[model samples]
Target: MPVITLSSDIGLNDYLVGAIKGQLLTAMPDCAIADISHQLTAFDYQQAAYICGNAFGYFPGDTFHIIIVNFFDQHPKRMLLAEYNSQYIICPDNGILTMITQSKPVDIKAIPIPATAKSLLDATKLIADCIKQMITGKKPDTTEVKDIEEKYPMRSAVGTDWIDSQIIFIDNFENVVLNVTKSEFEEIRAGRSFRIVLMRNSEFITRISDNYAAVQPGENLAFFNAGGYLEIAINKGNVAGLFGLQRYANASNMQNRLLYQTVRILFES
Candidate 1:
């Protein structure tokens, strides 16, 4: 059965996702519809890219990914039918395509969705139209590729080095994800010890936790997330919302304008 995977920042509140699946089923009955995520931060392209780029490959070949982040904004209604590593993606021409394409040889085709459709609902119908045609063994009518945009995989943009002790992303747990990779942090350690400070007001946690359980229950501590980024988190608190920490592509409140301020990663090396 053909599969459709959905990724979006749209929370599970409205009937938007349900309506999309209903439309898809209307065209292709018995279609396997899965969810990459519906909890991505709104307009956070970095998080979307990370979630999609990392997980899309895990599914079977030719799975269609519908990404709705920043789609209906003031930007042009440029949909894309992108094929990378045997997977099909339908999304806006926003830099997301550039990031997900990731140097891989992809067939980028423009889609004139808004022209044929009147409103966003119509646009959704158009998207269903494209997917249905593709699933029915027909080549979807897609526009030619235009100019390419630069999509940086990391938050700080491309061509820039990750600074030591730099904060990266904030997770749902309010855990601050630092840009410093395990290898980078290890190099800086060089057998020397280091301490982690939270907001410079709380007690300084001197020990680096190898796992989440390193800290006492309900006690906030620092550690590396599965992606190997350093994370600052309360054992059980809305650290992000509580501390005003922004997650994934959100700018932190720092004077550098280059660095975010929610949780700064300072080192003793």
Candidate 2:
């Protein structure tokens, strides 16, 4: 049986998630299936990319990853099947595949969506059928899919003396993940001292902690997380609630303009 993973914005609140799984299982009995995350925010491509990008590498080679978030942002014409890093990515042709993987794939095929396929469940059924064909060494279409849409992940706006990074993610613990990775931080620092200025520069963290214990309980700290992005947190504290930071959200709303804030790093020569 083939291994399949699912990532989506459908969440688990309803029967849709279960229905998707049922389709995949009915297509291939005894097939191993896993869930990356089903509670992802809809239309938040950057956040979804951050999550799916980090997750896909952990699965074994040839595993098919089906991402269903923002699957219908446009008229449904065809689906995408991309071969990348020895794995398979099945997603809608909504320009988000590049955002997740951050690369252009040379091998991609278009899996046509039948006119009868009107709902999300119908799409999953199509994907399930395609997977069946693939394992038997077949493709829905042999012609390479060209002229597909593409989008890149949002990167921090860098300055020579400072770096401004958005709060791309906020974990269950309320710890914040910035867009700036460890290597990006080091490249900008250049052996200079720096301060992580937050909340309109009202608060500052002068050093990166080795761990939560590096600071006293309820105190703040900065560090590179396992994913290599800069993280801001407090020992046994709710960093987002306390500091008023939030996951990337509505840019037009005044509150979200403040909530969808960035963590600033100012380098001192």
Candidate 3:
């Protein structure tokens, strides 16, 4: 049986999720459906990319991942179907796919829709049809598959003594995940001592904890999470809430404001 995983901003509070699942099952009753998440922040592609990128690789090859966040960006008349690393991803062409994979897909196609078919329900039906066709080994017309426009993830700002990173994700446990990866941190440190300073509170962490419990309860610590990204958390408390840290998209500002909290790591010379 085929495996279908869903990640979306469509929360469970409404019937949309159930309705979509029903449509999928009705078309392919034997296929297994899995929920990656349904509570993604609306139109937040970075958050969706981080969550999906970390989780998708663990699933069995050939799994179909349906990402439905920011589906209506600019009222798109087409959706993208991409195959990467033996897995399939279906989502809007609003750059989320490129953000998730951090590269262009091996195979990509644009599924067109009639201008009259503009509702979310219509879009869901179209997605279901695409899923069915792909599973049956029927290749979509070559003309349908087109070059996908790409979008890049935010890069950390690096200096001789400092690496300025942004909080890319905040998990349910309220742990703050930064864009700085373990390898990047180690490469820059080169065995020198460093200080991780939080721009929000002016507080700093000097040690990298092996686990959350490495520190006494209620104390703050930093560690590279399972995804290998640096994370800040309290042993038994909410780091984001306590530190007043949140995730926001990079955007223009009239005053050139910083949208999210920044974590700066300064390596000792």
Candidate 4:
């Protein structure tokens, strides 16, 4: 049976998610439907990208991943159908695709939206139709998907003695995930000791723990998460809530924003 995965900002509290699933099943009754998340922050592509990017690789190669967060970002006349790493993704023309993959897709096409379609449900049905066609070995008439016109998530700012990063995601347990990866940290460290400074140097973590059990129940720790990104957490506690760390949109003056906080790693040479 074909597998279809859904990630969306449409919370489960409403009928929209069920409606979409019903539409999908109506088209292909035997297909398996899985959900990545339905509580993604509205219009926050970075968060959606982070979650989908890390989760998509674990599914089978032919999985069809549908992302509906901020589906109207550009009021696009067409939706995007992207084939990357042998998986298929259908989402809006927004930059989330590039943000998630960190590169341009090799095979992408545009699925036209009818001019009369205004409601989100209309678009949802269109997506279902597209999936049905793909499952039957039929290709829709489409144009090449274009490059994103806007900026995506920022890379870590590297300096001689420090790597400046930001909190990309904070999970339900309140553990903080940074934009820096383990390989990036090691490449920059070159065997030098480092300190992870939190909240603009108010506090710091000096060791990379293996897991939550590596530290006492209330102690703070740093480690690479299953996604291979560096994370900060307090064993059996809410690190993000306690430290007041939150994810913010990428802006030119992001540092000056009221809730903005940058996670810095200072390497001792």
Candidate 3 differs from the real structure by a C-alpha RMSD in angstroms, to one decimal, of 2.0
- 157-237: candidate 1 lDDT, tens digit per residue: 211211334344555556676655667666655656565555455645666787767777777677766666667777766
Candidate 2 local lDDT, 1-269, one digit each (tens): 68999999988899998998999888888789999999888878889988888998898999999999887777687889999999999998887789888888989888888788889888888899889878878756534688888988878889998998888899999999999999999999999999998666578898998889999998889999878889999999998898788786635665636434777889999
Candidate 2 vs. true structure, TM-score: 0.94
Per-residue lDDT of model 4, residues 99-144, tens digit only: 7777888788887888899978898788888888888999866678
The CA lDDT at 207 in model 2 is 94
Best by lDDT: 2
Q: Candidate 2 lDDT (Cα, whole model)? A: 0.86
Give the C-alpha miss distance for residue 246 in model 1, angstroms: 3.5
Candidate 4 has a TM-score of: 0.93
- Candidate 2: which stretches are off by over 4 Å? 141-143, 250-260
**TM-score rank order:** 2, 4, 3, 1
What C-alpha lDDT values do all the predictions have? 0.68, 0.86, 0.84, 0.85
Arrange candidates by lDDT, descending: 2, 4, 3, 1
Question: Between 1 and 3, whose TM-score is larger?
Answer: 3
Task: Flag clash pairs in model 1.
Answer: 174-240, 252-260, 253-261
Pairs that collide in candidate 4 are none
Query: Residue 6 in model 3: shift from native, Å?
Result: 0.8
Distance from true location, Cα of 29 in model 4, Å: 0.2
Which has the higher lDDT value, candidate number 1 or candidate number 3? 3
Deviation (Å) of 189 in candidate 1: 4.8
Q: What is the TM-score (0 to 1) of candidate 3?
A: 0.93
